[model samples]
Target: MRHLTQNWHVNILGFVLFLFTAVLLLIADNLSISYKEALTFYDEKNLLHYLSNLSVYFLGQSNIALRFPFILFYVLSVILMYKMTADYFKYESDRLISVLIFMFLPGIIGASLLVNNSIIVIFCTILYLYYYRTYNRHNYVLLFIFVFLDNSFAILFLALFFYAMKNRQNQLFIISLILFGLSMYIFGFDTFGKPKSHILDTFAIYASIFSPLLFLYFFYSMYRIGVKGKRSIYWYVSMTAFLFSFLLSFRQKIYIEDFAPFVVVTVPLMMKLFFHSLRVRLPRFRDKHYKVAALTLFLLFVNVGVILFNKPIYLMLKQSDDHFAYNYHFADEIAQLLQKSNIYTVTSNDYKLLKRLEFYGIHTDKKSTNFISIKPLNVYDKKFQIDYFNTNILNIYYVNLKK
Candidate 1:
């Protein structure tokens, strides 16, 4: 019975976390088609188009099919993180704090519920942390697979991991670098000079600039890791390489998942200090500090509460007034037109209608999936005719087939 209680308590934490995350994600999924619409309008539509037409040789499933797998990966990541935190700290209180902090992480919370590359980032980060804790090289292989499955910018985690390994295993690090290069080319990025003007721009720029100054703090913490004696050159070089990588990724939308490895490394380095400071002072004025800490935690949760909860609240209220006015009208008109038609090709400059239909699960024949430009409307291609359209930007239409 005692052993059962212990195991129950142990597994229950992760179970609760997964359940909480699943609930939050469902809320996001149910709110509206806005988020998915944006995904289809921007980049996912191209990926989906590619997936639908993929060669027989490919092993991956379709775009929509990847969503649940991605969610499961994210759930596994948080569970792994909680275990790593618990194992590292040893103290139940500290472990609890770590779990709560991770749950409320502005970046983690924001990304976990969304069906995008951010979830990949979360999984990679947690996986790296777990690897660091276990000193397992096999985890690196998993990292490689996820990096391949994810988009190009996701390679940043691989770069950071290799940077950490370069000191002890030079050959392994070099191999990883080569693999990354090959992965980039194989995954569809042009390896030639200045391949794409906007390629990895978000990870290479914007996200890099936002890294916490804690990175510099981590550098000092490395001294405590005793890295200066035998591997001083490797340590310093690795730090410089990672810093440079971060600098290069400044403008890129690298997202928090890319930085997960870096974040996990700091746990061991900083946990002692966090605890020592708390122990020394926490005993002197218990109630006062407790109150202050509680308030701070509340504020942090509230800040995230706004992003995770309030946004949907506002969206739901706003949606009530026009719940069926625009989308239903548009869908009804189009569904009626194509109810019996054998059209297959669709060409439209406007992504909104196309994306909304896709979001609403309205599958149809082959879609051209091209962006309409303000310059001209090209509806008269050999493959498709202007069965439906808006003159303003060629909003929506159908070709002659079925999906």
Candidate 2:
């Protein structure tokens, strides 16, 4: 009977994952290509660039096609998370809850639908963990492969270095140090910017990723584990990334994408710490943790909801440009308005937007000489208010001819 209940819980999580995938597909369909994505699409070359190109080759150049690979990665990551939860959680329901939280994480959700390596990093990180726990020996082969993959895995190898040291695994520690060096050499850490502080900005980004209160708890969990609880390989990997990124932020703005994957994968660790603390307390005395956990979950849902239904947030912003998603919101609508005006094959001063427009069939030619300048209209204007919201989200774009 207990086994039956366990199977039922896992089955229900399976259903939730199915629905969540559909929602992600819908969100992908709605989002326009951002400047960064457009740059990646045309100018930049990488693994994601090739994969996205291949996806569009078969599925055609739609938003969903562009993002489908990452979405698939996200599904695999969720499955890996479920398998991972068994390591920390005794209760089937606890395992289910941990997996479910990982699925709805705002950072994970954003990564899964965007044209970047974040989702793949997450999938690979979890995959490595799953492999390390189960097979143990073959993980080095996986770690070797990670060297060429991304600079982000430097954090992974570094974490393993410490874990290996603690366990006195000489071979593992030496290999990890070599791999970490290779990753840095291949990727080349950027110290080009004048040294300044972006630690506050990094903190704000993390708050968004884990949601506010949960991020605090996540920090607390890591500190507590380091201070007292048993520090498993998982905690080491996560803490190493978290500490490395924030510490570097004081000198340079560290790329959160590189670090967030490792940190977020520690969800099971956080859950284990939370539950252990709660159970250790007297039932009547546990009210504080219960309330904090409830509030944390509430904040997580609110963050997820805000991310999924972000169109409404435009109304709250004092100006459209101030809207967090302004970059990813305008290109498709702009292309549609231009096509109606019979303006095809136009060039733009905005190179990134031009690349994005090109994806929507707005080709550019130097001989054609049509120039477009884009400006966002924050106020209500009768000119070219477009998009599904049927609000004044965008304004008229003036088209010109070169002299």
Candidate 3:
């Protein structure tokens, strides 16, 4: 097993798998900013994701090209997950199983493909955890990066504090606390209005992401493992973060995407418990080979079935095609319309449509030359004469900016 893991082909195969998934996501529709994400970006709610928006802006506003960086982050996240798992488990086969589980999980796949902060959070969290496990004097660099990247990562301080207390590293603990404070101050807290009493819905969302049956099995496995030892601190911290996020949602609505980091962090440990349980089977089964095989097949079937029927998977597939048809599919037509008309800026009441136009380089800024408003009379001055109007899937209007 060691020799097989050490083989150059193993790394090659992993890279090939990552590349295949990346390409599949790149081609998928709605890889561009979603409406919710667009609103956040436009409002400058989280500056950490500014890089993502900047990539879109710099790529000449092409949504397809914008997904390239995110795809790269997703690939790196998979690699980090493998490394973290290998660090936890001594065996190469165990590490490989953890990586495969992470790669195939519906939640991981959906988070990876979406153009949002979830992938960034997952990538940074894994990278930070890897550095934390291999703690060296230089590893503090990851802490700084994590804090600057996202305020939500402040949750990591809980684990760091525990580690510091256990190791008598008071200075490190103080430093992490300071960084957490700075992160909160810089990014500000995200508040989604008042929290809803949707605890059941929150659990359902998580189940949907991880698959209801698989998540139940994971919970059972975790209970059986019973946290202990220095390494168990990580698990406890991850669960704390997950529970905190879940509970916080009761007041300020946290989306499942927000829990991506915690979920991804706990996966390796869950798989560890699963593999451990398989090895320490009941003594009643003297010939355990067939039993083990059957159990493995059943688990695999459950996970695969969940992935195949996941609602987000179908939604993403359909949304991708729909977004392309309604948006990118009309790129050339919109561009031509703009080019022929004396319109340099276009305004729309629909923010999604406006952002899509901006992405297509249609100059949605009202300050630009040749401005035209596509909104109804209430939004634009009634005195601005309407030169032309077309109503289709997208409304286009050529209004006289002068008046």
Candidate 4:
């Protein structure tokens, strides 16, 4: 009865943590539509990001509603992360701490609110990994499903096949190879093309995501895991995947979603390493209760500091109008103005802005010669154009075309 009650309390605490994290993400600036989000909305390339588009299409196209699917997937991924951590680490506190760190990661938070396939991919990846680690059979179904989520995930099959081969799981290796071949046939071998050089930009992106301090800790943890841990294959696979993603990021336009797998796989390992270091260095602390309390408080402080102080995190939480492609605060007003004026046709060099306008129910006519061109009044044009909506973050002008 005592153990059961204690478990209940821990579960409740984890639920509360999830709720708090969700609320913060809900209120963050990234919840609004951005250029990348606009691309997802248009989806001209017909990529495998059907889930993201389908979610938006079914969810009423509202700013807040569009985020719900991603949030739901994000929560699911976090839960799976906890399960995976619990399975791997004996210490209950370490499991909880790992989940907490995942919840607070800036990359995870920002990615969760955007209309991108990354969150979904992360969720599927974690689920597949969790099942791979815990279940002895029926994991091939997950591999089959993952091929549809993103072509990049197909790389994981190679890692799994290698592991299976090394461990003498010949049946699993054969299945993985078959799936890999099928994925290649369907998704094509295009992802393996020559890499572009984005070495500096990629490094900058990683630095921003993990922050300099956390990145250092992550690197150190990877080093320790590779050198000391028996399950070194996991570390090698994770690093290889990260490198592949990093190199592929330059070959094409990749977003944070593309890096979600790398982040998901590494963060828990880093947390485990951190806790192990704590135990080793503070072995003299006699009171286990006090030690847990101190460590918990320290981690909470660090997470809070990261949220408040990190430049990207600060911007995400600030909720500025300029953060989005269309000024969300003034969206309804702009829509109303355009509708009232009977300005159905519009043109703009800023395609993202046009897409946002369209999402808000303002249609654009590319062929119409005399349509309104929405542009910044001061910056884009100094000529006499009717000012439609003007704000610190955005400016709109109604220019009459000579028909």
Error (Å) of candidate 3 at residue 3 is 7.6
- Tens-place lDDT digits, model 1, residues 8-125: 6466566777677666656444333343534543455454334322421253322333244445555676677666665656566676665655555545555544444565555665
Worst 10 residues of 1 by lDDT: 385-394
What's the ranking of the predictions by lDDT, best on top?
2, 4, 3, 1
- Residue 27 shift from truth in candidate 4, angstroms: 3.2
Please give, for residues 9-102, the per-residue lDDT of candidate 3 as tens digits.
4675477676767554545333334555555555664653576577667765555555556667777888887766655776667777677666
The alpha-carbon lDDT assigned to residue 346 of candidate 2 equals 78
Give me the candidate number with maximum TM-score: 2
Candidate 4, backbone clash total: 0
Cα error, candidate 2, residue 382 (Å): 11
lDDT of 4 by residue, 70-130 (tens): 7787788888887776666757777776777676666676567666666777777777777
RMSD of 1: 9.6
- For candidate 4, the C-alpha RMSD (Å) to the true structure equals 5.7
Return the TM-score for candidate 4, rounded to 2 decimals.
0.75
lDDT of 2 by residue, 1-403 (tens): 8886659977898899999999999999989998788777777788888888889999998989989999999999999889866656777778888889889899999999899888999999999989877776537888888888888998899999999999999999899999999999999765435699889989999999999998998999999989998999999999999998889989887779989999999999988887788898899999998888899999999999989888888866667778877788878887888788787887656777787888898987766666666564343222456544665665655545543
Residue 1 local lDDT, model 4: 84
lDDT of 2: 0.85
Off by over 4 Å in 1: 4-12, 34-68, 138-140, 151-166, 184-246, 249-272, 280-282, 285-295, 311-350, 361-403
lDDT winner between candidates 1 and 4 = 4
Query: lDDT for every model?
Result: 0.46, 0.85, 0.60, 0.62
Return the clash pairs for model 3, or none: 29-320, 195-251, 195-252
* Model 2: ten consecutive residues of lowest lDDT: 376-385
